[model samples]
Structure formats: structure tokens, C-alpha cells
Target: MPNKKTPTIWAIGDVQGCCDALQELLNHPEIKEDEHAQFWFAGDLINRGPHSLKTLRTIMQLGERAVCVLGNHDLHLLAVYAGIRRENKSDTIDEILQAPDVEEIIHWLRHRPLAHFDQNHLMVHAGVMAKWDEKKTLKLAAEVSDALQSKHWQKYLQKMYGNEPNRWRDSLTGSKRRRVIINALTRMRMCFEDGSMEFGSKDSPFDNKSNDIMPWFELPNRKTEKTTIIFGHWSTLGLMIRKNLIALDTGCVWGGKLSAIRLSDRKLVQVECTGKRR
Candidate 1:
């Protein structure tokens, strides 16, 4: 019996393989399937961690009940496996590429939303640009989502392997334009004090080498600060619990734990991920 309260939806962080941990987390005693429950995954379903094939299969089985956004890693898997991206030994997309249901998996993955999760909160693989107000962010997300779904999607994916547009502007051009939007929705980590998106700072939050920069959540004039955000992809930031944001990547591939949070009441759920990127 589905509950009339719209089913307690939980948003989970990156699961770079870590299938065992994912099973454990989903099977947690508190998450009762008997009740109406839904889940939203922040993305990065494959690569780095082991058993990506198993992980993708599991997520696919969940069907419409699960809402997942596209993460950089997930995109990497699709691009490489599809021959649009170069193969890196660090990623585990081969397993997924060689999987029996590869067609369905990639099709579904490519079609996943780049951003705009739900009403109260915006879901993304990584943090949003502190500069992009909700309106701009939504518009950018729509653009990328459109490109990914178009027949020229592979062209966009091939052109996606870069860090050129380090900052956002209203007048960027060509691939630069798409890259800025892509980076913001996918690879962004930190931002300068003035809100310029920083593409290279992957250190722990304490090591703020640049006094002018801070994590997206730590930015000063965040317009979306009032709107809750659910994001993954910052394994370095790990699981940070705050009123306005929820950082869900627990670094599962780096031997950290996989985290899931029930959005209805914000209950904590977790799985222990144990697999090296190699």
C-alpha cells in the first residue's frame, strides 16, 4: 500500500561500484519497503569502485521509484563505453560496457536528468555555481539535458573532455558555453571569493589554500541558500549535514562509506563501500 504522503523519498550519494555496501545501505532496518518509499540518487553510479555492472543493474531494477541525476562519472562511463570518451584504467566502465544489458543501461543513463531534482531541493552530481541563481541553473541544466538527448549527443560528449571555461559568463561561445554549463552541473568543486567557479581545488575543506575561495556551500552570497540542495561528487567534503545542503558522497571508492538520506524526514542511511579505484 503506497502511503498517501507521497512516499518518503531519500536522496543517495555516489556509488562507485560498492555494490555490497549499496545492498547493505538499502536493506537497512529503518528503510522499510513495506511502506511507500522512494529514492533519488545524486549520480556517479559506475566507475572507480568495483561492481559497477551490479550497481547499475540494481538501480535499473528499482524503475520509476528512483530518480537519479547524471554525475560526471556516470557520463564518463557512458562516453567511454560508447567510444565517445577515452578509456582510462581508473574507471570501471568496461564491466558495465560488457554487461549483458548494456544497451538498456546506457540508454537510460544517457537520458537521466542533469539537474533540477524536486520542488524544495535541487539535485545535482556536484555543487552548483554560487553565481548561478536558481533560474540560470535551471536554464543551463535544460540546455545540457537537451544536448545529451539529441542525436548529436555523442558529439557533445566527445567535446566534453576539458576544463577550458573555468568561469561562467553571459557571453561564452560554442563548446565553451556547453563546457561551462557541463562543468557547473558535473565537475565543479570550489569557487573563488568573488564566486568564480574553481575547477582544480580537490583538497579537504580545512585546506583552504586560496583565502579567496571556498566550497560552493561555503560561498557568501548564495542565492539558493534558502533552497535545500542534494549533491554528491565531492568525496573530499564527504557527508556534511546542514540545513540548506546535504553532501552525500562518502568516498565509497576511496574506502569511505556510501550515504543515503531520507528526504521526507532527513534520516541517515549508509553502506560501507570497499573497493579500490584500481
Candidate 2:
């Protein structure tokens, strides 16, 4: 059964290590005063902005009041921590990696869900493949989450990076299958008509479309079309709000606003952000 959502639940966009902005957003008069509000973060909690450690700590401290999905950057942090991947030049995760409670933080972060479903909304860091319905998306996300929490979690990280087998298939197994699931749920922006993803097009769907490329959500016959799909990660798309879709990444770490949506009423709350822009 889907968990019953509270009336004041807020779905927040990608934080990207913008702790100050997150603090500002939370301290908004309405949000701060609402004791009944619960937060559902659309992920990218850490990375590419200052205060990655502080951001993680703050969200971690939220406990049951906040639920966060794992974004591509968040997973990269784990892979780097496990020595399966190296930190890139633009990475801002050193503070998190070198924190005193780094291990504990990683443990908690790795356990976060890849997809969160409730109140008829499915939240992911990026796009869901056209093939999966709500149940299948949730189940596939769990498979990745389970691997992240397993004894050989590092092994999964080793295979986590890559863009292959771009299309989904039930028969796919091993690292190949898991890679496709992780890619679609975390890094995807555009996809072909056949459901194969396009990673290069990160601009607005309106300006970037050709005959073969379109936003994943715009795919024909998408099974999860009936359920509202909430996502972040495509900051260039900014704060997109449609009847059944919300793309809330407003480029907070890129000097844009940090955005949130009150799920019950679809009210938007935005906070101006002055975080470092890459």
C-alpha cells in the first residue's frame, strides 16, 4: 500500500550541497511555523556547492521528518568514498569525505531510497524509464538500494558508472541491468522513442528537441503517466510544473532559487540562493 501523505508535505528540489539555501528555505515563515510539515527532498543533497558536509549533517539530523532520494552526485560521493571512483576537479565533496563522521554519513546516505512513492507521486533524482509503471519503478529502485546496503556494496559501486544497455529489458542481469536502472533513475534527461536514454541533451526540452530526442516523461505510452512523477537533476529545465509532473531543480547551486512544492495544494515556495555557481 502507498503510504498516506500528510497535508503539509513539501517536495523540495536538488540541494546540491547548498546548506545555507536549504536553511533559508526551511526558515521561511510559513514552512518554519508549520510543525506538521514533512519534507521530501528530490535528491542531489550534496555536491558542486559549498557545505556538502553541513548539508548532509542537516538533512541527516532531520530524521523521520525528511525523506531524501539519492541523486547522481550523491552516488558519486559514495563511489569516491569507496575508492571505486575518483573525485573530479569540480567536486566539492572533500568536506564530506573528510568529516569526522564520514563513515556514518555514508552509511546513512547509501541507505536512502532511489525512488520514493507516496500520495500518488513518484519521486526520483532524474527520469523514470518509459517501460516501468509505478510498481516496477519502485521495485527496480529497491534492487539498487538493496545492493547499496549489501555486504559487497562496494562491488555495486564499481559497476555503477556507465551508459550501456540504454534500454530496459526484464532479461538483463548482473551489473549491466543495474547500470541501466541507475542511469534512468538518476542521470537521464532525454530518451529516444524506443526508451533508450540521451545523456548529452541537458537543455530545455523545448529548445533541444529533434525528431529522435525528447524528454523521457514526454515519451509515448509511459506507464507511470497516470501518477504524478516528481523529479530533480535537470536544473536547466528549472522549476517545471505540469498536471502530473514536477521538475523542481531550480539551479540552487548555480545562483538560482531553491524551490519546494506543497504537495496537497501545489503551492510553490522559493528562496533566493547565492551559492557558488559552477
Candidate 3:
């Protein structure tokens, strides 16, 4: 039987380590009025802003009340921790790396889902592929999660980067299969007409001057078109809400507002961010 008392669900945009803004949003009167409110973080929980450690710890303390999908930056953090990647100059995860609870933090982060599905809504850090429906998306995401949690996780992370095989194929196996899944679920923003993922564009789809590319969601005949997708990661796309899609990344780390939506009512709430752009 379903629990009749499920708490209010708030879908939040990327925090990008702006812990102060996140705190203010959490304490907003409308949100604070509900004692058992649940939070679904769209990812990039840390990086490129002040207080990565505090932001991560704040979410961690939420325990069962929080659900977070791993973003590209989050995966980059794991790769760096595994010594397979170097920290970028814009990265703000060093404080987390230097924390005494670093090991625990990494363990928790690696175990976070790449996608989450509940109440007919699917949430990912980025976009889903045109060929993938909700079930297949969850299955593929679980495969990556299994790899991340396995004893050979570091070896898997080592093989995780690359832009090849930018299109998904059912025949894809091993690291190639994992890479496609990771890229689609965590890094993808735009796609070519054939539904192949494009990694280079950071511009808003409306502002995209190219004729050959379109935002992944606009692809025709998308298998998950009937399922609402709530995602972040493309801050340049800002906040977009449509019948079957909601984009919540509002560039919080770039000094834009941190946004959130109450799922049941689609009520929007936001807090202004003062963080500097990287």
C-alpha cells in the first residue's frame, strides 16, 4: 500500500556549492512551513562556488529526505579523487577533498543514482536520450551505479571519460556502454538531428544559431515524451517548465537565482545568489 502521508516534494536546481543560497532557499517561509518536506536535488551539488563542503554536508544531513542524481561535475569529482583526472582551475571541490570525512563523503557521492523515477516523473542531472524510455533509462543508469559501487570502481572511473560513440547503440557493451549512459544522463545538452549527443554547446537552445542541432528534449518521437523529465546541468537554458519537461538549473554559481518547484502544485520558489561566476 502506498503511504498516504508522503511529504511535499520540492525539486531543486543545481546548487553548484552555493551553500548560503541553498540554506536561504531551505529556510524560505513557504518551504519551512512544511516540516517533512522532501528535497530532490538536480545535481552539481558542489563545485564552482563557495562552500562545496557545507553544501554537500547539508544535503547529506537531510538523509532520507533528499534524493540527488549525479551531475557531470559530481562525476568529475569522483574521477579526480580516483586520480584519473586533474582538478580544473574553476573547480571548488578541494575543501571537500581536504575534509576529515572525505572518505565517507566520496562513498556517499559515488552511491548516488544517475537517475531517479517516482510518481511518474523521471529526474536526471542532464537529459535522457531520444531512444530511451523511463524503464530503459533506469536500467542503464543502474548499470552505471553498479559499476561505481563495485570493488573495481576506480578502474571504471578511469575509463569513464571521452566523447566517442556519441550515439547510443543497444549492442554497445563494457566501458563504451557505460560511457554513453553517463554522457547522456549527466553531460548531454544538445543533440544532432539523428539524436546523437552534442557536448560543445553551452548556449540556450533558443539562442542556438545552428540549424543542425536541437535541445535533446525537442527531438521528435522521443520514447519518454509522455513522462515528465526534471533535470538541471544546462544553466544556460535557465529555468524552463513545460508539460512534459522542467529545467531547473538557473546558474546559481554564476550569480543567478537558485530555483525550486513544489512538485504537487508546480509552485516556484527561488533565492537570489551572490556567488561570482567562474
Q: Summing lDDT over every window of 10 consecutive residues in candidate 1, give the lowest-scoring window.
A: 30-39
lDDT-better candidate, 2 vs 3: 3
Decreasing TM-score order of the candidates: 3, 2, 1
Model 1: runs farther than 4 Å from truth? Answer: 1-4
Question: Pairing residues by index, what is the TM-score of model 2?
Answer: 0.97
Pairs clashing within candidate 1: 193-212
lDDT, candidate 1, at 6: 62
Candidate 1 yields a Cα-based lDDT of: 0.82
| lDDT of candidate model 3 versus the reference | 0.94
Q: TM-score for each prediction?
A: 0.93, 0.97, 0.98
lDDT of 2 by residue, 1-278 (tens): 99965557899999998999999999998799987688999989989888888999998888888999999999999999999888898899998888889999999998999999988999999999998999999999999999999999998889888888889999999999999999999999999889999888988898884899899999999999999999999988999899999999999998999999999889899998887844
Give the count of colliding residue pairs in each prediction.
Answer: 1, 0, 0
Model 2 has an lDDT value of: 0.92
- Tens digits of lDDT, candidate 3, 133-246: 999999999999999999889999888999988999999999999999999999999999999998999888999999899999999999999999999999889999999899
TM-score-wise, the better of 1 and 3 is: 3
lDDT of each: 0.82, 0.92, 0.94
